[model samples]
Target chain A: MIRLLEHEGKALLGRRGFAIPEGALFPGLPPTGPWVVKAQVPVGGRGKAGGIRFAATTDEVRAAADAVARLVIGGHDVRAVYVERRVPPGREVYLAAHVDRDLGCPVMLACPAGGVDIEAVPHERIARVAVDPLAGLGDEDAAMLARALSPDGPPPPALRRAVADLYRTLVEEDAELVEINPLIVGADGTVTAADARLILDEDAAFRHPGRRAIPEGTAFEEEARRRGVIGIELDGDIAAMMNGAGMTMATLDQLVAMGGSVRGLVELHGAMARGPDHLAGVVALMASLRPRVLLFNIYFQFRNLDTVAEGIARAIHAAGPGGLPPVVVRIRGVREAEARRILEPLDCWVTDDFARACARAIELSGRPVLRR
Target chain B: MAILVDARSRILIQGITGETGRAYAARMVAAGTPLVGGTSPGKAGQAVEGVPVFATIAEAVAATGADCVLSSVRPAAALAAMTEVFEAGIRVAVLYTENVPVHDAMRMRALARARGACLLGPNSAGVISPGRANLADLNDARVRAGRIGVVSKSGTLTYEVIDGLHAEGLGESTVVCLGGDPVVGTGFAEILRLFEADPGTDAVVLVGEPGGAMEHEAAAVVRTMRKPVVAYVTGQRAPPAKRMGHAGAVSGAGAEATTAAAKLAALRSAGCTGVDIVTDVGAAMVAALAARRGAHAS
Candidate 1:
């Protein structure tokens, strides 16, 4: 999911025929008296994190923006802030169009209780209508959602159109989720989206054409993406690399079960096809973590294991003798004899047994690092 | 006698002219698993490893009477390829392509269900009824046809399960990969139902991972099944909100059932012989099968 910042989500909503509070990314003020200054972070609970501030004057806007910029909420740095024209105090509502995986359909969710986390709201309070993708949103769907917003009488005109438009945006924009929290129904009866959260579908990039994912995850993960492999950096001491995602998780589970902590994890996504040099690069990336021990648990069927063996051998040789941490490998599958022969001369502990190799890596990690 | 596919099913490659398609074609021919025909849009009337290639799935199905197809198209062509496969009235279509858009998957899944056909995956490793029909990523030479049916999300984990089963002198009656996507065509419940009814399958081995309510849903079906299920859900120690390689493997906020511990516990409560570690899967299956036999004897 490509999580859009508050401003970005609003930009998408605004362009797609929704009335959004006039806003600009911080440092530039929107033409208005009182403004709601919000920290542009991907995480939720920014309001409670002291990431939100309201300012009535231009000078106050700048001050609030500066303060929010220095704040980090949910371990994410507030790289920017969004300032928008504040809507007058009015009725708060929670509205969202999301893909309901359990139902295998798109659903428009409307709740009268807004401003707070929608999950906390009782199930009976929310109105959820599943929309047919092929047929698109219809009048009956809009009417049902509208009734949720205005139980006593006719819904505000802004809402009657918003439900259908919201569902349309989800389908056309290829978004997994489009949410407007505290969709304010002002005293003047105008509907305003004060806050928005849009999660674009990453796989829909083919249709979207230039929608780049805001680079997420740690530097190791980013590097892994660049290298065409998958890497996740965690807070641990043992660094493990595996041939497949399932193996990666199973390896992580095994290590943790044995009381071993993993600082780095790498999955050789297409490394086998890319050959030894690419795998060596991934190994080098793992080695940079300065882990206590490096563990490679790789299993193959049709693909030869020698390619990975050579890659490890290359990474070890490239690191030069005594230049890297302790290494343990558990590799077997097709061409096991050839794979073992390739890694025979390396100083690393090589075995075909998964448990023994994991145990060895854990034991070595307990020892103080000799090289790093 | 296999659940999804067998020696009788005529399997074709949707993008047979391409590199991956050609490789699958060659492997299918080598395995002697009903190598029928394929489609390449422009490369009609060609042959890859003795399998005939056509202009489209419709033409391939008409010419060779193919009821099943293994698609190996690029990501951009993944959706269109499945659309053609489904439109041609293919009974079973295995979308071997990965990175397909979620919307496309939803559409194809809906279409498959509407047509009452089975769609394996958008990121699927494919399926194989060992020694009968080999459509999966697993080496055909390595696996043998047996009574235990295997179903999993990850192909690599399936590899481990297959090896464990082999170590225990067990072999699969059929292996179905539900793909590693957040939303795949088939789920654990569907496959478990098939295994329960399959005469070839005496017991089932369900390999699950953290992320998605599919495991819990499968647990619902396991409660009614007479066949014993040995379940293993990985990623118990996976960090929060982290996708452990697969697009779908994550225990995010509010997704309580997607966590490994929760899924495993759910399946165990459904009477599955739970395996804590993946390596213990084969032994757990042995115990579960024995328990079933002991019950039968009583």
Candidate 2:
């Protein structure tokens, strides 16, 4: 999921014909008097973290932007501030559209009580409708959401249209989530999105050529992304490499349970499909973490183990003697004998038993194996 | 008879001209898995390694009477390919594409449910009923046909469990890779229900990971099953909020319901034995089977 900044999200919504407060990314201010300066970060709880400020004058707006730009909320550095013309806060409501995993459908959720935490909102206040992916958000469904937002009377056409357009943006943009917290209903009966949080589906990036640049996460993550391997860093001495995500986690759990801590783990997610050289590059990247022991717990179904073996051999040859860490390999499935034959020349302990291999990795990491 | 695919299942490969599709076709044919025909749009009349190719699934089905489909279309075209498969009355489909848009997945799942068809995955490694069929990614020679049924969210984890079971002198009746997606077409509960009714299946080994309520749903079905269930929920030590390779394998904020610990507890409470270590899964399955046998003997 690529989380879009407030301005980017608003711009997307605005393109799809949704009403949004006029805003500009600071160091430039919007041509207006009253403004809300918000730190443009991907995470939530920015308001509570003092990342949001209200200004009534040009000097105050400049000061607010400066304050917000310097603020770091939720460990993310605020690179920019979103300055928007402040609408005199009226009835605050919450509206969002996202793919609900449980419902197995695109769902539209709306609540009359919005500005506050949606999690804390009373169950009765929240109105949700599962939009059929085939038919999309129907007229009845939009009206139902509108009624839920305004219980005393029928909702204005603007609210209904906004709700429908929000769903449109969510579907058309291939977004995972599009949320508007405090969807403000002004005193003059105008509905506008005060804040936007859009998460585009990374899987659907092929359809979106102009998708915003992905923010660099951790240094290890950036390197992993560049290398096309999944590398997750942990605070331990053992480095583990596995074929799939679930297996990687399972190996980590088993290693940790046996008194071994993991320095990092690299998941061979289709990396081996590119052949031995690509796999070697991934291994070289994993070695950069400087782990005490490198553990390979690979269980390939369709993928040949010989490819992985050749990759490990290439990585070892590239690193030279004593440059690489002590390695323990537990490989099975698809050309196991051939893979073992390829790795025999390397200074590595190869086995088919997962437990023994894990124990060896822990011992090499200088940790005593825990007896149950 | 095997649960999903058997000797009777006439298989068709969608996107049969693609690299992955060609690989699956060759393996399935070599394994003698009743590979009847295939379909690749604009590649009609082209025979891929002795298998007849058609332009669409309907044409393939009409020609070969294909009951099951192995869909290897790209992520962008996966949904359309699945629509073709389901619409052509294909009862079972193994979607081999990964990274399908979540909305597309939802719709595909809905279509499958509406048609009462079994759609395996949009990211799935597919399923295999050892010796009987070779629709999955597993090399048929390595998988010995036997009585214990296997269902898992992860493809590689299934290999680990299979190896562990082999060490305990156990083999599988069928192995289903549910795919590691947040919203998959098939879930643990559905597969558990199939294993429960399968005469060849005496026990089940469920390989689960941290994240998703599929395990919770599986527990609900396990509570009613007479067959013994042994479970290994991985990612016990995974850091919270980190996507551990699989898109669905994430420990989200404050949602303990999807955590590995919680999933293990649910399975245990449902009268299933849970293993803390991955290698111990075989031992746990052996114990559960022993207990079931003891109950039967009495």
Candidate 3:
């Protein structure tokens, strides 16, 4: 999942027929004055972090943008600022639509008290309804959420329409979540989205042709993600790879338990679909970490293990004269005999035992120098 | 006698003509899974591993009386493929495609609920009742039929538990993969209830990880279950907010409830043995079952 920056999210909301404050990215201010200069970063709590600054007039907007640009919220450097015409604060209400992972269904949520942290909002204060995956968030349901948030009597038609629009954006854009925090309800009963937080499902990248998602993680992790593999960088001496996410975590747990320091970890997702050469590239990426020991813990059920072994063998050969870090491999499961044969001639320590292999990885991490 | 799939299930593959589908079809047939027919759009009347392929799920169901389906289509086709299976009246459906969009999964889950059909993962490893049914992605040779029912979100994690179980000379009665996605079709609570009712399952191993309240949901079920449960959550050393391969495996940065440690503690407090280490689960399971048997004897 990739969380879109506020400007990007607003652009999407504006396109999807939702009322968003007119905003422009850095260098180009929106056509109106009395704006809020907000730093564009994926992380939340930007307001508390001083990433948002209020401004009036073109001069004030420029000054606010400069100040906001200097601020870093949650370790993300403010590379750009979103300048949007400020919607006059009447009542800050919150609205959102997302799949409730716990409830196992799509849901629409709203609260009268919004601008603050929603998590802090009492459960009873917030109004939520499970969106019938079949019927979707209908007109009645939207009115229900609006009425619940209002609580006095009835809500404005625009508020009800906004509630429905939020759910529509969530489904139509293939977004995991579409949240409007501080959905300002004006005195005239107009609903304006003060901020938009959208997380697009990366798997639906195929359907969205031109939409660009912000890249995450370190340089190595970004490279790994580009190759359709999950890689994480740590501060240690061993770089390990595994076939599945669970196995990867379990291997990390075991290695850490045995006093092995991990420098990086990679889950060789779709190893079979991505052939040996592609796997070799991932191996090379792991080797570039220059860890003391390189580890691979692979277990396959229907997948061929030899494909992984072949990938390792190819990486060993492709590393050329410098070779690779001291390789420790724990490979098992389907096509084991063939997989072992492929790894036999390589300069690596191969084992079928998980504990023994992790132990060996730590032991090798303690070694002084690599002979290769 | 297993909870979900068994010897009597007439299973079908949604994308049986594709490479992955064809491969699983062959493996299913070789392992003696009751694979009746499959759906491959234009490949109707054709065969993969001697099982007939239909143009659509309705045709396959009508012709073969298939009630279970294993869908091996692409992520883009995940929603449509699942809709076909659920609409065809398949009681059990496993969406094997990985990287399926969450909205698509939600729609699929809703369809499953509306139809009263059991829907497994869009990225699930599938289910297996050992020698009885081979709906799971595992090789039948690796797992032996036994009295312990194993339900996990990860097929790979299940392997570690199975290996640990082997160390204690224990095998599984039924192995169910709930899928690795954050929004999956089923959860631990529902599966635990099924295992609780199964006559063959004496104990159950609930394998979970960080993130989501699914484990907490299961903790509620564990308190009332007659059978013993052993909970092992991975990512003990996982950095918070880091997506640990499985999209659902991330530990919420500040929220204590979604972390692996907190989840394990919740399950343990509910009166089940919770182990931090993966390899220790089997030994814990053995001890739990023993204690239960001792109580029964008394």
Candidate 4:
């Protein structure tokens, strides 16, 4: 999930007719008398990052922009600065919409005290509503959220309409997160999404290319992608290969709990669909993991084990005994006999035992599998 | 007593002409899993692994009385496969395909629900009632039918757990991998409900990873269950969710989706025994069973 800066986020909101402060991302400060120079980064806490500075004079604006642009925090590059006319202080409120992984729908969360960290808001103080994709967020729900934020009365028709439209834009754009922190409802009672931060899911990038063109993944992700293996390097050393993501992660967690270091993780969900060449790629990749012992713990519910076995066998043949790492194979599910037959030739200890498989992996690595 | 499939269940294989469907058909037949028939749109007049082939689910069901289906269609063709099975009135289906479009998953899920069919997965590893019948991506030779009901989000993890149980001189009543997707058809809670009702299932072992609320939802159900459930949550120290193979593995913005610590806490708070290491899963199940026995005796 990549975070869009406040300026970009607000610009999108403004384009969608949401009340937003006009902002511009400039390499250098505009020749102006008054402006706020804020460091442009994806993460929050920029104000505390010593990156937010106000400049009343044109010369001051240039210097502030220059300073803010050069500041880097938390490894995020700061090459640009946001210049905008500062709005007068008013009651700070917050609104955010995101996909609730558990409920399996979009959820809108709001709180009246928003300028502060949203995380700091009391759980009960936060009001939440689920938005069904099939049925769009209706008027009553938007008005309810507005009322929750403004308990005294309903938000004006314009603000209510804006809120509803913003929610619609969020769904239409296929966004994972569209947050407006300190959605200032000014003393004059005008509501504006003062800070707009959006995070769009990369998986849905194909449908919404306009705002969803995800930047190339990080270096680690790119490297993993090239291998056709799901490589998630963690703080441990016992690299593992499994058929599914949940299994891969569970193995890593188990190894970590057992006090073994896990250097990498690979989930071959569709590798069974591929042939020996795919397995060869996996073996070569595992060799790169530099694991003291590679764990081939595969459980197929409907996939053929022979495919995994063949892949491992071919990879071992390609790597040769000297190049291959000490390997332990714990396989189950359909085509087991055939898969084990293939792995047996590669000196892989084929077992249908979970503990034994893990023990072998740990033993070969000369490590203890910790328990938690 | 089983929730979805049992010893009496007859199974049908959809997409039986495909390489994957054929492979599973051979294994299921070899395992003596009450193999009935298969369905492939244009391969109706043939036989796969001695199982009669029909062009449609209705014909296959009529010919073999097969009430359960293992769908092995491609992602793009998943909906059509499901529609065929659903229309045939199959009571249970395990969709073994992944990367299906989200819009398709929703529509298929709704269709399955409307038909009162229990759809295991859009990316599921299928379900196995141990020695009774096997209709999943799992290795038939490795699983032994017994008392423990193993439910997981990963097929490999389910195998690992089943292997652990085998080493302990135990086997599964049924092992179900709900699939590793955010928008999967079946969930932990629904599977737990099945385990709670399965007379053959003495206990349950739940394996989950970071990046979904399914585990947490299951934890809530476990709090009210009569059976014992042991859970293992992965990605404890997993550096935040990294996008790679599975679409469901992506971390949603929540404490429940991306953090193992949070999931583990929820399980524990819900009164379910939570273990961190996969290797300890067997021991946890044993302890849960023992604890249940002690409580029963007292």
Candidate 5:
């Protein structure tokens, strides 16, 4: 899931025929007064984290914007700030649409209790309606959601239209989540999205070319993105690389179980599509961590193991002696003999046994093996 | 007999012109998996490894009476390819493509259920009925057909568990990889039900990881099962919110549903012998199956 910044999310909502606050990204503020300076971060609970601040005047807005731009919320640097025209106190409601895994469908959630923490609200106050992927959100579903949010009386047509539009944005954008915390119902019955959060489905990037512009979280992430692999940094001393995600996590679990820690993990997404050069680059990137032991727990089914073995051999040769950490490899499947033959010259411990490879990695890392 | 595929199961390879597809086709043919035909849009009338190729799944099915499809299409073409398979009345499909859109996955899953067919995965390693059909990404030579039914969320984790089981002189009746997506076509409960009804399967090994409530749902099924289930839940020490390679293997904020400890506890409460360590999975399965046999004998 790639989280869209506040401006980007609001722009999308606005495009789908929803009302958004008059706002602009920092350095280009809206012409009017009484603005809310919000630090543009992907994470939630920013309001509680001092990421959102109110400014009464233009001078105050500039000051708040500067403060927000310099702040780091949720470990993410605040590169941009959203300065929006602050709406007056009104009926604030929580409205969100997300794909519910258990329900196996898109679900729209609405609550009369809004503007505040929706998690703190009682279960009875929140109304959830599962949107049919086939039929989509019907008029009745929209009306029902409106009524659920405003049980005291009939909700205005604007609220109903907003609900419909929200559902449309969720489906049309291929977004995993589209949330409007504190969807302000003004005194004049106009509904405006005060804050928005949208997370687009990363897998659907083929459909949306604009998704390529989203920034990576870290330098390692950026490099991994360029290399077409998934690299996550940790604080441990063992660098683990694997072919699949499930295998990567399981390897981490096994390593931790043996009293070893992981400094980083590099997952080979489409290892076969990429040749040995890519794998060699990935191995080089993993070596940059200077881990105590470079652990490779790769199990391939369709892809050739020899290519990976060649890549490992190449990476080790390029790194030279002592440039890389002591390596422990557990490779199997698809030309296992050729892979073994290729890696025969490398100064590494190679085994088909998963446990033995992990134990060896830990022992090489100087971490005490805790036998269970 | 195995729950999904057997020697009689006629297999069709979708995207057979591609590298991965051709590799799988060769392997399946070598294993004598009854590879009848394949489908590749515009590449129709061509053949890969003696297997006839058609323009559509319908054409392939008409020619070979293929009951199963192994799709290795690109991510963008996965949904359309699977739709064609389902429309052609194929009852079982193993989508080997990864990074498929969640919406497309949901649509494929819904269609599969509506057709009363089993869709293995959008990011799955496919399924392998050892000694019968080698549809999965597993090496057929290493896997032996036996009594233990294996179902897992991760393909690599399944390989490890299968190795451990083989080390203990046990083998799988049917190994199902439910894919590592947050939402999958086949869940643990559905597979467990199939394992329970299979006469060849004496015991079950559930290789699970922290993430999603699928494990808990599987535990609910385990509560009513007559056969013993030995479970190994991984990702115990993984940091929160970091996706552990698999898109579904992340523990979200305050949600214990996907935590390894919670999954193990839930399975144990449902009478499954939960192994904390992945290596101990085979021994636990042996002990659990032995306990069940002792009770039956007494």
Candidate 6:
């Protein structure tokens, strides 16, 4: 699921008739008296990264926006700056609605302390209430949760009912996360969802039309996704490919365990339907990652390895002279020898030991391979 | 003895006129799995693989005495399809459709439970009693009928595990794919209970990915089972927080939703015989079976 930035999240809240601070994303901060220039990013801990800054003057707002927008968090480029009207300090109240998972239903969680990280909140203070998908949130429970958040005024009865309805909004829409941090209760008894954060589960996207666009992928991730494979860019120097999500992760862990850096990861999914051409695409993609070594730890049951091997051979030939990553393949099940026959001709090292393949990957990376 | 299905089981194919339905129907009939007939809304009097087709499941069951059904309808129509099968009084059913709404799954699950009918998957690959019944996505040529019982959420991984077992001279009595979706109609624990009671099932090999408490819950059942269980949890080395594939694989922090290590550890603590990789599944199965035998001798 792609995380919606705070600005977009707050706008969604606004559409749902919730109170939120006026926000705008701007290429440059306009000449304004005061504004909060926050970096629009998907990663957490942005406040600690100095991505969130309060600007007292137009020049400061412009400077902060320009500076923070250039910063990268979790490898994602911060393209635009989220500028908003800063709210006055008040008591922090936290509220979130998410699927409890274990209960197999949506749950609403609320606590009086909100501005700080929810994880850091004391367990006893956090109150959880399961919302029935069919019956929805009852009025009494909503009031209790809202009262638990603010004992003094305890959110007006109507507001508590609204909060309950918001939970319904999250569940029926298949939202993975709906968080309101520091639900500001002004001295006038006005309740506002001050900080909004929502993450909609992508698997349930068919239910919410036009909620998301077909996401753009990085050069590596795009190639892999197109082949119905999972791909991720990493900092390591070894480019690794494997069959199945489970094996891809194991290979990555093994590489990290062996003191090797993984540059990229490609997982071949539904490999039987995917012919040798998909394998060829994988080889070319790994070559583009420009790793010192390419590792394939494929374990197949019904799928044939001959097609995969043939694809790699074609990719190697297509790579031109010295165009391939020094390969280390560990293939098992369904035509092992035929796969080996295809790869052995390319001069790629072939083995079945996961650790050995990793060690070879490190060695070929021209780095001192550290023993696990 | 095997679990859920065997050679004697009579099966019916719902939506047999559809491409996937027709394909599996032909394979099942060809493999000689007592596929009596098929049901399509408007395809009555037609034939799929020379098996008579009826417009409704009741008519098909009345004519052929079919006990099992493989539902291959689309996601939007899966619940209705299963409901129709249940109404027809089918004892067991397998739903091969994915993307079923959560509410639909809940209704189907509740209806199946109330009716004393066993539902395999909303997104499941139909169960196979190799050499006897071929009602699944797995190719019969790749499998052998034997004493092992295999249950998994992944179709390809199930094929991999069964292939490994076959390589070790073991054959499965029934291989059930519980489905890879988060809110599938049935779960690992429920299937384990059925396997435990099945006379044909000598042992069970459970293939699980990191997600849900299904494996952990199943582990609790395995702790008390007389039959040996070898549990394999995939995604042990999954990228810490990045969801790879499968909706069920997503997890929350410190919550054991979908961490392979956490799942494996939980399974072990609950007295399950655990293996980390597919390659080691056969060896683990052997080890578990040996322990069971030793316990019996003692």
User: lDDT tens string, model 1, B1-298?
Assistant: 7988999999998888888888888888888889798888888988889878899888888888889989878888887788888889999888888888777777788888888899988889989999888888888987878999999998888888888899999999999998888878899999999999999999999988888789999999999999999998989889879978998887886778779999999999999998777888888889888888899899
RMSD (Å) per prediction: 2.5, 1.7, 2.8, 4.7, 1.8, 4.3
Per-residue lDDT over B90-187 for candidate 2, one digit per residue giving the tens place of the 0 to 100 score: 99999878899888898899899889999998789889998888888788877888899999888778877887788899998999998888888989
Q: For each candidate, report what fraction of the true interface contacts it reproduces.
A: 0.64, 0.82, 0.80, 0.52, 0.65, 0.15
Q: Write the per-residue lDDT of candidate 2 for residues A20-139, one digit (tens) a residue.
A: 887888867778758989998888899999999999998998888888888889889997888888877788889999987766789899999888889888887799998888888999
TM-score of chain B of each: 0.98, 0.98, 0.98, 0.95, 0.98, 0.94
What lDDT score is found at residue A215 in candidate 3?
A: 80
- Tens digits of lDDT, candidate 4, B65-124: 889999878877887788888889999899988766554565566667778888877778
Candidate 1 TM-score to native: 0.97
Q: What is the C-alpha lDDT profile of model 4 across A140-194, one tens digit per residue?
A: 8888888878876767666566668767776766666889887888778788776
Candidate 6 residue pairs that clash:
A236-A261, A236-A262, A236-A263, B1-B200, B1-B201, B2-B200
Candidate 6 total steric clashes: 6
* Candidate 3, B148-230: lDDT as tens digits: 99999999888889888888999889999999999999999999999999999999999899999999999999999999999
lDDT of 5 at A171: 84
The CA root-mean-square deviation of candidate 1, after full C-alpha superposition on the true structure, stands at 2.5
- By TM-score, the candidates rank as 1, 2, 5, 3, 6, 4
Where does candidate 3 stray beyond 4 Å?
Answer: A151-153, A320-323, A367-372
Cα lDDT for residue B16, model 5? 88
Instruction: For all candidates, state DockQ relative to the true structure.
Output: 0.70, 0.78, 0.77, 0.40, 0.67, 0.25
The RMSD (Cα, Å) of candidate 6 is 4.3
Best by DockQ: 2
C-alpha lDDT values of all predictions:
0.87, 0.87, 0.88, 0.76, 0.86, 0.76
lDDT of 3: 0.88
